[model samples]
Target: MSLHLRKPSFVLISGLLLSLAFTAISLISYYVANQSLNQHITTNTLPLTSDTIYSEVQRDLLQPVLVSSLMAQDTFVHDWIEEGEQNPEQMQRYLKAIQQRYDAFTAFFVSEYTHKYYHSTGILKQVSDTLPADRWYFHSRKAPEEFNINLDLDTANTSITTLFVNHKVTDEQGKLLGIIGVGLASTTIKELIETYQSRYGRQVYFIDAQGKVTMQGSQFSGASDIHEVKGLQNIAPEILSSPEGSYTYTNDNQTYLIKTRFIPELSWYLIVQHTEQSEARITTTLWINLTISLAVIIIVLLLQHFTLGGYQRRLEYMANTDPLTGASSRHAFEMLFQQILNFAKRQKHPVSTILVDIDHFKTFNDNYGHLLGDTILTNVAKVLTQNLRQADTLCRWGGDEFFIVLPNCHQSNALLIAEKMRQEIEESLQVINDQQLHVTASFGVAEYSNDETTVSLFNRTDLALYRAKSKNRNQVEVATESAFKTV
Candidate 1:
């Protein structure tokens, strides 16, 4: 096939081809060099930046949740409700005790089941919103143990940084008591993520437990609504899902480095993003290199009439093998299987086919997210390649599945290997975004018989796989004799 064709003299055409070849080589080299440099810098800096921001946010967010959880379980609150009477003096004493434990707790406040803000620790006080005769907190006083009674801050006040933890104080039979709540400054959380972003010259945002973007910084502030940014959804649904992973994306004609981690204690997500605006400026210089390459090609074409070279026939054989997995493609596998069949006819040795399907790969994509899915696929491919013998072949069939040709192996041997693969993949945990994803694979094994043809062997293997999947996935099963007999 002609690499290029533009009408020109023989000498010019030959020189042009040579110039084009050199230019291609030069372009490839430059791309490799640039990527390596970028990767080196990113590798050195990204983890430190991600960790710093994550640590800062984690402490701030967890502090509130922990304190709230602790207070909700406090013995004093339970005792007070069981006493069956509201004593203003006793309530003030309990509030003072809690305030001493947490310095951030500037005041201890109470709102009754009727929503009256009547009691305070008297350490620090504030103006209050109107109370309802029967408020949401009244229901919390009777809530089940599993239910978290943190007040939805938006329901109480939009202007203040506040979190309220309410618990049921019941008698032996579960009676309601007055509701207690504490409000704190929201500026504390704002300062937490913002402080780290400022320190590292990075950008950070905090999404609430419900997946809403609650806090964002100046660098990320351009997002009219952070939820509208496609990149955030591209990662896991929760930052805690993948505690640490860094990927690049292009947005609004700009490239960004995104790192995500989850805060389990607070059920919040921390996201750090960096724009590679400076990198884009460096990349623009690549166009200049292309122009210089074109000019050099013109000169070479003038001198040699652009003579060119070509590939050897052996290169076709090389092309058939997968460089990443070192396995044969469908075409090459078929050819090799035919060759094996011929050899077996002369001196018989049984051959088997194993079809392996990775289980819940969609969940991997959904849970840990897609980039990690690719990583899992690669790791699984490597594992399959490692398990096969030199004489056998393993090929990625498509989409979280693989095909293996076990030459000269009995059904027993093939079944044994399949079971091993199933077990290993099941117990394996791949770390992505600081979370561990447990993955598994299922297998169907079919052996070739003297009566079976090449196509029939594959058909039986496929049928066996259908049976395996139907029987509640994640195990290996061999094709029954009846399965191949009809085929």
Candidate 2:
């Protein structure tokens, strides 16, 4: 059942009466509201913004690392390296495909044994133990980690600096074969970081495991290393060790609140810095509040309707949304589904539901870990959402499963749509937590029948889904409209 809220007229009337009472304790209410706003900024706004920036960074920047991982795992690269790397043109073509497909700045491979560097354009150069410029190749080969991100100037491909993700290639026996990876233009990344600052009104930058500031906007004056930054220097060691947390520090006599998240894929720390001093500079707002305190009746009477309605809308949204995937909540879905069913019955239009389940999701979750699983789930939801029509409704039915309602669509058309969605997912690779993954989904389609309850219809759909899974997964199965079974 949906909530029925009283009209904002009631709130306005109540607020007008309260405004008169507020004229008596206006000073006290001003202080309380000021404190509440400050707390809200720090507690809710900053952390929420931090999480958003973290996700965007993962989506935008971590892709190259994932691409490099795929390149490392490709059999063609393995076979070519194993065969003595004689075909330079073939390797160049392969590298070119990787670069163009991903839109990376450059793609390259370095052979440790032959000390030869192959770029998308062909052979770039040969590395040597003595050359300082080629130290990155030797360091990548000697490092215990499977991959390394080196930010350096690219003299071979572009004259500008680039961030290269170098991943180690190995044979079936796990013996080191070579190194392969892609480069991203530093300028492009810097521009992206700058946009984050303007968009979120926070200073966003990245620091390596050792505290060196590896990435930041061009307009930002963040120090080269966290240790050199005024306030962070004191807590640099603790910040480096902690996986994720919010820390407060004083920098240049200004108090700053910073949230740190350890991005394991890139081995970098995402630092989102917010200045509390700006909010604390509430002198102007405090004056306005005190001034409004004198005329509290006018202010509350003026804005009460907008404030109450906005808050009610926000609360309703929070209640109706799935926190993890941003899809409709089951409660919200039920309400919407019933509305659609009623309308379809009246208009005599077809309505169909598709049940989508990620095949072998539990195994993927177990092997790759929950973080990767959540990332995959989020991406899958985005894909489904993008493909949905304006009238169609998609809901997070449960973990790793999505329920889609296509109004005015017959079972056959819905089945075709499901097949399209399946093909899109099947053809794409999802990279998460520094690992590349191929994801495919199974779908079950069902059309609404006369006087059928939601429970009975979905039960049949679930049965069809079970059949699809039983038939080796990643295929679509259909349920007859005439079938009626309680779940």
Which of the numbered candidates is closest to the native, going by highest TM-score?
2
- Per-model RMSD to reference: 22.4, 14.1
Residue-by-residue lDDT tens digits, candidate 1, 1-487: 2333432445565665656665665455456555653563356445545665565554454544556555555555665544443565666765665556565443344444434343443323222344452354545554555233342443334456454444333335555444454444556667665666665556778676556776665556654444467665554354435655667766668767767667654455667776664545546644554565465446444432322222223345446775445566667777777777667656778888899888889988776544467678777877777778998888767667788988889999999899888877776645545777767777899988877788888889988887888888888878988988888
Q: Residue 142 in model 2: shift from native, Å?
A: 3.3
In candidate 2, what are the lDDT values of residues 1-487, reduced to their tens digit?
A: 1323465557657766655554544344345654565564466556656765666555556679878998899766876687688768989998898889889999999887887889888898888879988898889989999998877888485578888888999887889988899998888767767876875567988889999988888677767888988878999999999998888888778778888889876688888887664445554554554454435334434454565566567668867898679999888899899899899999999999999999889988778655567778888888888888999999999989999999999999999999888888877645556676778899999998867877877887888888888999989999964555434
Candidate 2 runs further than 4 Å off:
1-35, 155-158, 277-487
Location of the lowest summed lDDT over 10 successive residues in candidate 1: 304-313
Clashing residue pairs in candidate 2 are: none
Provide TM-scores for the models.
0.40, 0.50
TM-score of 1: 0.40
